[model samples]
Target: MKDIAIVAYQQSDGVSDAGAVNEVELIMPVLDRTFEQARLDSAQDVDFVCSGSCDYLQGAAFAFVAGVDALGAVPPIKESHVEMDAAWALYESILKIRMGHADSALIYGFGKSSPGELPIVLSQQLDPYYLAPQWVDSISLAAMQARLMLDQGLITERDMAEVVSRSRRNARSNPHAQLAGDVSPEDVLAQETYLSPLRKADCCPVSDGASAVVIATVEKAKEWGLPYAIISGIDHRIETHNLGMRDLTDSVSTRTAAEHAGMHDGKVDVAELYAPFSHQEIILTRALGLGEETSINPSGGVLAGNLMMASGLSRIGEVFNRIVSGEAQRGVAHTTSGPCLQHNLVTVLEKA
Candidate 1:
């Protein structure tokens, strides 16, 4: 409920695969740049460190432990980790600032999707005892959701192709985007489907990347004398883990999170939505009550390149970039997890 804002953000050069660089190696420069942009020194200025990343993507449990090295965390700065996306960690970091426990918070998320079978590995996020054993890859589950939407007339293949075309075209302006620039619905329709109702272009390309954001209290933000985007609201929620138990066409979690996060209070000038599958973008936009007038995914969003744990954080970074650069006065950034938008986080940001 207290005021907190993001004053700085930075990211790695997203690639399809980052084989030679280790996790710490991948994140160090990004971490340094984030602090530098914030006009703060790493050890002296940062009061807390909270990060979001996954163990599965790295193929090792406790993978985030190594990320502490990037922080140069000696003398023990306050820290925590979430198994969810880094955007979720931003929620935690801001909460820390609100609690008056820390004046400033550093948040980051990173992942390398190329190390193993990403889709196969993501199956573990399902009901482990039941659904996961069925080996339900992420794309297959998303395909089922897309089919349900089409069956009910929520969206069409043409609608999906349009989303892909617009999103990739938008990505051309984003230097960090892995895939960007012009493509047509007809050309996309010509591509082979990886899953029924979900073509390759309709889904995000796998990417290896890292992202970082700095959060500060209002007074600290002012004292730092840097550009800042105030956090208006933040919330996240989860739905039933069993995909079959819920409505595949709608994301109840997103609607609930948006309500709690107050995303509908006013018109959002821009949005950074984490829709890995094009159909999911349709569902999310509907859930958030965003119309054609709203600027969706100006930074190209996760559909251009989804780097697992880092994509959500990247959504936050995109919005922060817009606010800091005076391009948008207000925006909403959203992130999702599990199969078919099973979990969602929404945050409202405003420029001062």
Candidate 2:
């Protein structure tokens, strides 16, 4: 495989609703920032372009076509799209470079989840024959998983509360985070449960936002005179769709992907995990075998702001930011999809 480096990353401020902001409006500013960071003129500067988004959120077929307007594709650039998060789009860009199809690529993801009942809207993505018919919301599915962990003695309510407390506190420093403050675990425990075993704080807020990343081969990075982070390894795995057949307390797919991504090859200084629920953070930590020496979610993870299709890419971008800032020499970024953490992607990055 050819060496790939992330040279630039940018994201919009995560908000509860980008009211009156169409998807293209939400995307253009982030893309402009990304291009500026990379010192590129526009999408035409890269050999290929790819995006990640969900048309379901837009409530129309071929809705993602409008996102291309942000790229100014009048001259026609090689481009692609994924129905999944933008992290997967990054994965695709890596393949393009490895195949010598492109030397550099631009990637972005965007979503406006406020107009619809976000959770209910996501329910339609579940198993159409079973869970979809019953309209099992995302929060409810996560609550059931949390309950299983609690009943199995794998985690405690206080343990879950502590995760939320830390996320909010850490998010205070991240300008892009939507939720941030200095709340204690005790304060969280005092709040009423929104879904039986899970408090409202335990769940990630529905957010409207966009994120963009610029990546290229090592040779291209040197030519551009840009500081970059090396993508040491990246891989993803998914479990069976049937919820009843899997173990909720453990992240089997995460562990497998971590192994494949070579996460255990060296010390991990930090981790940016896309855990939508607080308890799921604990699950991913255990699965990745991260110890006290490793810092988790310095950007507050998705608990601070869940930007649907973009948070996954943000995880990778956060790790890149840390490495470039001299805060961490090596780190991992984890992203997940599907209900109850059914699908997972793990990426390792090192300073270049």
Candidate 3:
């Protein structure tokens, strides 16, 4: 495979509701910033363009087609779309470069989740015959998983609260974060539970926003004359859909993906994990065998502000940013899809 480097990354400030901003409006500004970061002009500059989004969010078929308006494909461009998170779109772009079909590519993800019942809409992604018919919302499913962990003695409510407190504290420095500030575990524990074992503070807010990244081959990066982070390794794994069949307290798929991605090949300086819930962070940390030496979620992660489809890609961007900024020599970025961390992708990046 060809060595790939992420050259540019950009994201909008996450908001609770982008009231009047349509999907195209949410995507255009981020795209413009990404192009500028990469020292490019437009979609015409990249060999390929790919996006990640869900039509269910728009309640319309081919809703992602409307997002093309942001790209200004008037001259026509090579592009594609994925129903999954933008991290998967990044994977597709990597494959294109590896095949020598493209030298550089643009990837972005967007979501306006405030327009619909976000969790309920996500329920449709579950098994239609079993889980979907019962309308088991995402948060509720997470709560079930949390309860299982709690019962198994793997974690505690206090432990979960600490994760929330750290996320809010870490987010204080992040301009794009929707939730930030200092909050104690006691404070989070004091709040009433939104769903039995899960407090409102434990859940990621429903957010509307977008994120974009520009990646190219190492030779292409040298040609562009930009600071870049090499994607040393990347791999993804998924578990069985039946929630009962798998261990809810552990992230087996994450462990497998991390292993295959060469996460432990060298010392890890930082990690950006797409853990939407507080408890999930603990699970990922243990699964990856990350010790105190590694900084986790310096961007506050998804618990600060989840952009749905975009947050996954943002994980890779966050690690790349840290590496290029000299804060870390190497790092790992993780993205997840499906309920209860059923699917996971892991990418290891090093400074170029």
lDDT for residue 41 in candidate 3, whole number 0-100: 92
- TM-score against truth, every candidate: 0.97, 0.99, 0.99
Which of the two, 1 or 2, has more lDDT? 2
Sort by TM-score, top down from the best: 2, 3, 1
lDDT digits (tens) for residues 129-238 of candidate 2: 97899999999999999999999999999999999999999999999999999999999999999998999999999999999999999999999999899999999999
98-179: candidate 3 lDDT, tens digit per residue: 9999999999999989989999998999999978999999999999999999999899999999999999999999899999
Candidate 2 displacement at residue 326 in angstroms: 0.4
Candidate 1 regions exceeding 4 Å error are: none
True-structure Cα RMSD, model 1: 1.1
lDDT of each: 0.87, 0.94, 0.94
Candidate 1: minimum summed lDDT over ten consecutive residues — where?
A: 39-48
Candidate 3: how many backbone clashes? Answer: 0
Against the true structure, candidate 2 reaches a TM-score of: 0.99
Clashing pairs in 1: none
Better candidate number, 1 or 3, judged by TM-score: 3
